[model samples]
Target: MSPQPHEKRQTLAHRLLEVRLQGRAAVLKGHHNTNYVLRIGLPLAVVLGVMPFVRFKYRVPLKTVEVVPRIWRSEVDVLAVVCRHLREVPRGFAVQGDRSLHRYRRGIVLSEQNPHGPVDENMLREFAAFFVRTAKVPVKELPAPPRDWPVDGESAKFLHWLIEFTERRVHLPNRERFGDLFDQVGIPADAMAAFKERHLSLVSRRFVLLHTDVHRANVVVRRKGITVIDWELAIYGDPLHDLATHIVRMGYSPTERRQMVDLWERAMQAADLGPLTAGLHDDLDTYVDFEYAQSVYPDVMRAALGLPTEAGDEHFRVAAERVWSAMDRARGPLELKSVKDVDQIMEALRKWHSMDAVSAETTVV
Candidate 1:
């Protein structure tokens, strides 16, 4: 039997992505996916041969916590919805098996140009415009939300669901492996509960499509405008959540963050999305708190997991500082009575590394 068209596309994509291929191919590695980029030329009959440059992305298998529903099962559905409405988003042609191909956007990542730098007024306005455009997309056009997704426009329920997801998926799943380390670093099991209780006053706002992960690295700056890539983490939720994540992940200074919020409010108002910004000033911090609270688990766990097998004291020190910083930021939200000192965190990392090494040796034998 002949291979299916989808199968052929997958095969060709894999072939073009091979490291041994003789061409100008670049492998872009990200936390969740590994992308292989190359330009090809051929007859119109063949699949994707006419494109200037194509990116073949395969999801990397890793033990990760699920904070939001990834359209990984069929990214094409969401991509269709987003690209149809927003030209700045890269269009995904197809998702076959584990591989998905996208038209490569030729530009420098915003992070490369300005890492954790302040955005100028013009760029800030553009960023706000993108958010406004995304927020205006009708939910009917989006793929069905996950079964546990909160009802549309239910901001309070959405926040509660997020807390539940963090507790159920992020914390419980990894408790067996990292529970002790979590305790050593001052993260108690009741942390999420306390956070949820403190943040119950979230003002209701109409939910909308949100690019949940809008960090600098995910944004490509072209001469025409900014193209936001990596829509895998996109979700339909309170718009403020997206803004909060962007502010935190973009590493904006205090003044820049305030300016960005003002710009976002103005843009939304101009687009007649005033309702979406209702109680934004009052509730934005709650969303920011949630971002901090939920991130601590992954930040600490990834730090520990990222240590090299033969890591020395310096590695442990770096990992400890990373974990400590996450804890410090989360203290207000999680109501942590005290944060673990750097030396304490370093000792805990050293122990975890030793145990991890022993486990690896056992499996090897």
Candidate 2:
């Protein structure tokens, strides 16, 4: 008698879990293929052929789950491996670590089954507060951000690098990429050039630890507290970039988004962190706009996956258009003077949202 294919896969999964978990006491609690609950475990060691980095250890009670439709189950499994590794390291935010974890041989297939729904406004605010608190911690004390230390006049440069890096096909084709929906909308090349030119310098501000992918799905609300997972994209960068990414991905309404921004401002102020000054806020708005503009790139996934290009293009076009219309309504004339004016920033946000609305309508029909 021999093990069947399903049994073999399960055996491999269990073996991988054991190797990854080392001697840690963990229970496989859920029926999902890649789900487990690990309570009170020491960090697993990563044994390289050469020197072994001291794995950061944390005893936090953790539950890990990864769900991928049949089409993307393989890719999801790879992602789950990375997630499991991160869970072993203490001080690991959602995005931080070596580039090896960033690479995957396959692309994700996103459908209604895999769609990330809009985050609730209240949850958005709470996560915003949590992110701000986590980000403000001095770098030396925790995991360093994924890039060079922040130098003045390099904010835009950093952002450009990130956008380019994210767009690169080597890591993941823009279309198959999870977050490249903005590139699909038909923004004129000139509009994109102007948008980038106007705000490339925004990246030069103070850098902080950022989750990089702070969307609702990455955050799991548990009875203990909000536990943010997935740090493959975590980096040391502009805090607002993190906020903009989360807000855009969450797909919140303009009014709800605005309220979340207000909550972010108040939380920062109350913490004596800093004012949400006008320039900074506008810069965040611009980041959101650029992200919206690039949303269409994800349409490329259709061709990559051997699906009908026209249908995929149409789907991406609609998504990009909606986000662009929202941006149009959310943004205003950029009056970014300093980094503390909350009102001016909110105006810009209003315009961005308006633009996103137009794009959204175009996407539908």
Candidate 3:
């Protein structure tokens, strides 16, 4: 009898491991995974029934999140649905242990290609097209959402859930460890509550698949077109949330941002997805504001945690600048009383660094 699907996965996984152990795999560092790329040729190539030189990406998950859900768990299931309908997405292969494998597309990443500022009109339209395609994916086909995920078209409730997730899972859990730093850096503990109060109402629109993290780094510019990778953060929710995240993460200039929004609306209308574009003008900014507001916690925490053990003035300066930038973007949305200047932020970092070092030493002893 032919080997079952799981058996085939195991066999392919074993072969990939042998290659990785032999040091034939090229390594790339990612925030959540250590990716090893291998050009699987010969008998293994036949296993996928493709060409001899098909490359594959092998990912080993890092213990990056304390309480946040393992992204790959949702990512694998989401990809199964997306790959069935879209060809630009990478085909998820299998998972073994905490590691997984998928087809690796060869091309320059959009970030590397553009490097800075806005993309051209052609690229922008392609982005809109991709978004429309993603929106058309039937909700029933998606894997079950998390407990208490807002029902479809409940935009206000959806935004509330996201804020609660950030506050509850991302912020509150780390408050003990990072609270002092947050206070010193001018971020009030009540920032989220204030945001919730200010943006209490949002216009309802149909929920669709949202690639909540569609930055330039996650997009590969291929000969055929641009292929968006990294489905790890995909979620079902307000479509505007996807656009808002894309706009902020892509760092589009004011004119380009406006143009992109127009393109998106036009594309959605043409595709007969007008219901998804409901309240495009009135409520889009709310989603954009929410993106900025939620990002501050992670950005500040990461900057502080990124400091080297023996970090110097230069290292502190970099971390402080990162924190300052995140806060500057979020200040309005979060309704902060004040934002710390770089020097003030640096001082806060210094204090946190000292405390962290002491904590580490105590734990070791």
Candidate 4:
């Protein structure tokens, strides 16, 4: 038999308490993701990791690479592989664990989160230089690229992944809802096709191991400088994807986004990696489109859960506004036939609130 609901809460609370045992301050709920992160020191925090592969554990913690991979980790810990080679990490952390614990995995120690906001262009440029240089750091020999990513041309491989991910992963699971989302936004469902037609040539230009998940939240601001964290999503794809992900996820204003691209290009050029920044003139939008497009599902799911109730009208409005942004950006890829205004989208979210409680009721554009 399974544990009672309260029993489950107790278990989670117990785990959180264990996570906070070393903290100098309160254990704070992480800004995003399920992990409960604790402020261990002035510029230090440790993320209690959720298991990576298994999806439905009621958002419960699962086994994860809590240590610096170099200190201790499995072969698949590519993040650690990079940590082993790179120096400009968030801060140094060694693995800490004990035998008595049941569920408290060693935490992913990081410098404090990037003051919970976007980094400036100068910082972004510094990060770009550090990023590519780290990529250039010659490992004794780069291990075989991910199996999903064969040792093939970067452009073709990621294009294949993009379409496959959207169609199979995004469209398949939430077909009706995703289709409705597209219809509501007046976008073509064949957005993936558009991505290929437009951006394919650009990604083909360069091949470098990329810290694909570099965004503001993952970047921690320190007194000295910024430290990039969250290396798990790192992929060996077009370097532009890194820039695209950073632009979108950091919530960089349009001006800053453009500056980010320019700064990145200049940084790469200075490093003599000019070819790496190629195709930004036209192809960057393709990757940005893919980033926004792919995010529709996850964004909706988050909005559904976090939207406010009757007493929380203001919060709900904020959540609705965010959903509106996601839908608006993803309109084309989602293949909407009609554009739903923000008010309509807000109402839809209110209607969907009941469904949010049903953890397994998964479907969204």
Per TM-score, the best of the predicted structures is 3
Return the TM-score for each candidate structure. 0.92, 0.51, 0.93, 0.67
Misplaced by over 4 Å in model 2 are 1-121, 142-153, 166-195, 275-278, 302-365
The lDDT of model 3 is 0.84
TM-score of 3: 0.93
lDDT head-to-head 2 vs 3, winner: 3
Candidate 1: give the clashing pairs: none
lDDT tens per residue, model 2, 239-333: 77777887787777887788778888777777776643335567877778656544433322222222222334444344434444443533432
Best candidate, lDDT-wise? 3
| Colliding residue pairs in candidate 4 | 182-335, 182-336, 183-336, 183-337, 184-338, 186-336, 187-335, 187-336, 188-335, 189-335
Off by over 4 Å in 3: 1-8, 11-15, 41-52, 66-72
For residues 1-365, could you state the per-residue lDDT of candidate 3 as single tens digits?
99888767667766656664586788887777788888776765556555666788877777764533332364667889999888779987655555666789889988788879668999999999999999998889998887787888899998888788888888898888889998888877887788888888888898898888888888999888888997877888999999999999899999999999999999999999998888897788998998888888888898998999999999999999999999999888887767889999999999999999999999999
Superposition TM-score, candidate 2 onto the true structure: 0.51
* Backbone clash pairs in model 4 (N, Cα, C under 3 Å; residues 3+ apart or in different chains), count: 10
Q: Which stretches of candidate 1 lie over 4 Å from their true place?
A: 1-24, 43-45, 49-72
Model 2 lDDT vs. the true structure? 0.45
**Per-residue CA lDDT of candidate 4, range 1-365, in tens?**
99876445445545544554554332233333244334332211222243322111011123431211121222224444665566555222222221111122232222244434555666766677666776575543455554566344466566567666666665556654444543443345666666556544545656666676676555555566655654444556567777777777777777777787888888788888887776676678877777787776566656655654442677667776877787788766545554567777767666556544343345432
